[model samples]
Target chain A: MRIELALFASLEPYLPEGESASGRRTRMIDLPGGITVGEVVARLGLPDQPRVCFIDGRGVREDAVLTDGVRLAIFPPVAGG
Target chain B: MGSLLRVDMACLTVKKEPVPAGWAKYAGRALTDAIIFAEVPPKADPLGPANKLVLAPGLFGGTPAPNGGRLSIGAKSPLTGGIKESNVGGQFAHSAAKAGLAAIIIEGRPADPKALYALDIDAQGNGMLNRVDDLAGLGNYETAEKLHAMKGDDKLVTVTNGPAGEMLMKAAGIAVSDPHGYPNRFAGRGGLGAVMGSKGLKAITIPLGIESLPHADKEAFTAAVRKFANALKEHPVSGQGLPTYGTNVLANIINEAGGYPTRNFSEGRFEGVEKISGETMREITLERGGNVKHGCHTGCVIQCSRYYVHPDGSYWTKGSEYESVWALGADCGIDDMDGIAELDRKCGDLGLDTIEMGNVIAVYMESGKAEFGDVQGALAALEECAKGTETGRILGDGAEATGMAFGVERIPVVKHQAMPAYDPRPIQGIGVTYATSTQGADHTAGYSITANVLGVGGTVDPLKPLGQAELSKNLQIATAMLDSFGLCIFVAFPVLDIPAAFEAIYEMATAHTGDPWDADALMKLGRETIAFERLFNESAGFTAADDRLPAWMLTEKLPPHNSVFTVTDAELDSVHDFVAETAAEMGISKP
Candidate 1:
């Protein structure tokens, strides 16, 4: 399945070499037909720290299963008003 | 010794007194709280002649501490009728410290209501209180520019109020000059500006030059400062996240958590989140040829401030931060960035609290005074405040009054002060702080989010009601200590996780002040600061009943998160017990 993953702020430093810049990265990976959102974070080598992940615009838990051709956004340490 | 400058408005007298012994133990908010407790009588009206306004710089303000130029302004709030401490960042603290002044106390209102006075302190430590007529009715921006022109250099630091303050509006705030002569930074909250206005004072200006004070161990201080700065550079939030995105970064996160208050606390999410989030702001600024990250004062490493520009690269606004964005954008149901920018500009010009002003307008909208998503109507409301019109009078009365006027029951406030952007139903820990803090509903009173997130062993999940009261108690005490040091709360992000970094800074303070102390001693001082404020509030007729969230929070359930503020009254009462136990652990008795 193919999907796009984007990182922001300090999380950009943890991205793979070719995908470390300021845009989205397209990657293809083999899955067991269906995989949970937790598996996607682990597969991308993202931090294991608890954080909110967004699929398109809605919040989804790490255990929620993902589908092909979805856009994922990963964030680190929430901060706001 | 750092001296106190006292200005008596009625007599036009100025006195400088040496700093009292043991005051060095507490700085910033702690010091201001102590002073307010010692001098002002509780029964006195906040707008009456007996009330006093106290301003104190943080402990590390003059030094090269990262994000350390925070100033605390304490007074009896005209709006809340409780003890209040409002903190802001500006050049005033650095200048005041350079001039060897510990705090500025203004007391005794002028007998004449029409006369306006300006207080100026020169390099020789001598102060001049003059009656300046040209400053009357001038907005903050124009007042600052005229004062700068009158002083004829960048040597003077001016703090002024707009028509909102001059008109004695309950939501008024004092504006301080930014580095670029823009009156952007503000001591905003609790209607302290109205207190100043009631005194018949227009502004306070300090003219300072480069001067160094004596240090106990310069080498040790330098070494500890360098180590602390290095530690900050290593942390993600302090090192990069804050510098890159400022506090606006939380818009998306809060929206995702379903905790972002939208449209008068009706929902927890806003559909136009993308336009107001930090990422979008950075992108928009870049496209508009503006600087995304800028520092507030000298020696600040975490430059979370920014200069927002328009499409033509014109100066649209300065320091368009997170609270202002949420208050003026999401809460008011206005999604246009240009409209938000214009509102920010108007708030700056009028010397008003953006949070209170925005919330007041939303109340007006709810009452059918204006329609939802009416950006032009919002602008017109701000214009009324600038011109001091009849509608402006209603708008300047703050959230509680506006809510009362409109008969809106969903008003989000605690202690008569408007709550900040964070809705407490989902994040219950902050709700605890808002309820218990002496400064009324303030988010920065104790920002326990970091400690809670790091799972610092005893902390509870924000989503759960269990142990949140105790957690908030600890955070409030710790934050009081940080505020006393005059250190920026942002330093706590790193200092909490790595205690050694803060220890080094504490050692430096002890070495400089020649006071025998450790971390435990600092915590004791924080407790004392809180006790003093509590005492003041108690004397001012505030019982435990006054320390609570608005009724709507308990009865209403915020959507998406589907969480109601489940912390009961008994749990809230236990918070005071937790504070008392902490004091006992430190071998201190209750005040």
Candidate 2:
């Protein structure tokens, strides 16, 4: 299944080469249907750091399952303005 | 700082009066609000002779305490028609405090409206008002440069008002010279610059002082400062995130949370967010040879500030902070980075509050006076303000005035002040702050985003009203105390999550003032300060009706979550009622 992924701030360096070249910050990734957010992070070779993850604009835990067509967004620890 | 330097602008006289015994411990917003309550009549016209402008430094200002150089400028506001204190980070606080000046109070409007003067303070803290009529219509950048040229010292810090202030536009703010001697740091809210302009004052210059002020318990203070510094460096939010990407890091996260207000609060997110995110900014800065991680003041370990540059490596502006970018980019429907940077630079040069200026331009766009996403149109509108044209005056007066002029109904404001980047519909806690904050629609007044959005202290549901009132109340009280200490608000991240960081604040204050300070004493001080501000607002004719988000926010649901401001009016009243009751328990008086 194909999923949409968005990485921000310090986590942007983890984007795939094609997405990185696009300079759009968002990328499409082909992954297993039953992948969890944690598995996705691991597969993408993300650094061991504090992060906040969201699926389709709703903040969710890493254990949450991902499905095809869902937009997954991840960000490093950020303080408000 | 044992003396209050009072400059009577009408008579062109300066006097150094002994500090009030009761206000000896007060500094920053505490000192500014206290002086305003004592000297400025609540009902006085904000631009009249009766109103006074007060500049105060925080308690740890000029000390070795990291990020302790915040200056608070206060006066009755011409825009909100309420008491206002605008906090800023710059060299002025450290310079002024080193000269033994607790506060500088400017009183009385000049007899001649065209007269303009500059107040110069020497190393000994003696102040003199010099005629500066030639600087009546310059921008803050020009004013700072000319003042430095006149003094023959490029290092001298200057506080200046630009053409917006000279025209008495309500959105005008006072700019403080940064370490680089440019007027980029600003106390940019509630028309304090108009008050300064009304007094016929153009600028203030103070000699640079680098040595740390003496502390009562030097050993303990030093130990506490070290601990605090270590804690800040340890926290992921403050240490890693801020220094790496600056405050603009929140753009992606807030947008992901569906709380980033876009196109004048008509939507929850912006499609162009990625183009303007912190990652993009860092990439651009690195490519352009700009300083991505820079400190606003000396001894700042966080270093969240940045100096944005042109593509060819020329200096453009100091910062395009999260709020400024949101206001000019997302809120105005303009996603171009260079355009937003230009707006930020223009606001700084004109000494206008960027938040207010963006809101006004957004309102103008909504009214068909300009097209949304038209960068040239926005720039032209801002230039109109520089020229003081009729339309420019309306736009320069701030959001509410522009709304009134353009007949736009969806003006996002509280107490006539424009709201910051956060949309209150999805984030109910911040909405409570916007409605109840004494300073009028200021995010730093309460900043419930820590819990409601960022999960710094603890996680709270952003889409629901449960636990919001309590969260806003606690943060608001803590913010009041923090502002008084002259500490950076970013310290709250570590102080909330780390116990030692929390205790360091109390330990530092006790060692600095030679007093028994603790959590309870700090809470009481915060309570008293709120009570005093509430009393002043009451005297200035603010009633319960004034404490609310615009009616449209409560009725119109925002997108994504489709949430409206669900916190009831009674809950909003409870925030201030609790403060009032706490003040009574502490034997504080009413208006």
Q: Mind giving the per-residue lDDT tens digits that candidate 2 earns over B243-359?
A: 999988888888888889888898888888888877788888889998898778766789999888999978899858998989989999998989999999999999899999999
In the order shown, the candidates' DockQ scores are 0.31, 0.66
Name the lDDT value of residue B277 in candidate 1: 79
Cα error of candidate 2 at position B396, Å:
1.0
Docking class of 2: medium
The models' CA-based lDDT, in order, is: 0.77, 0.88
Worst 10 residues of 1 chain B by lDDT: B450-459
Can you give the TM-score per candidate against the true fold? Answer: 0.92, 0.97
lDDT of 1 at B147: 85
Model 1 lDDT tens row, B1-591: 478899899898999997777666667887788787778888788989888998888877566666667888989889889888888887888777778778888999887889998888876556778887778989888888888888897656788988888899989999887767678888889888898898888888886456645567788777777888887777667777788888888776666556778988888889887778787788788888988777776677878888889889888888478888888999988878878988988888887899998898888888888886789988888888878888788789898888887788888888888888878887788888888888888888877555433232234566678877877787778778878777777777777667776787677686566667688887776777777777778788888888889887887888876778877888777666644554455343422
Docking class of 1: acceptable
lDDT of 2 at B590: 46
Q: Which residue pairs show collisions in model 2?
A: B1-B100
Top candidate, metric TM-score: 2
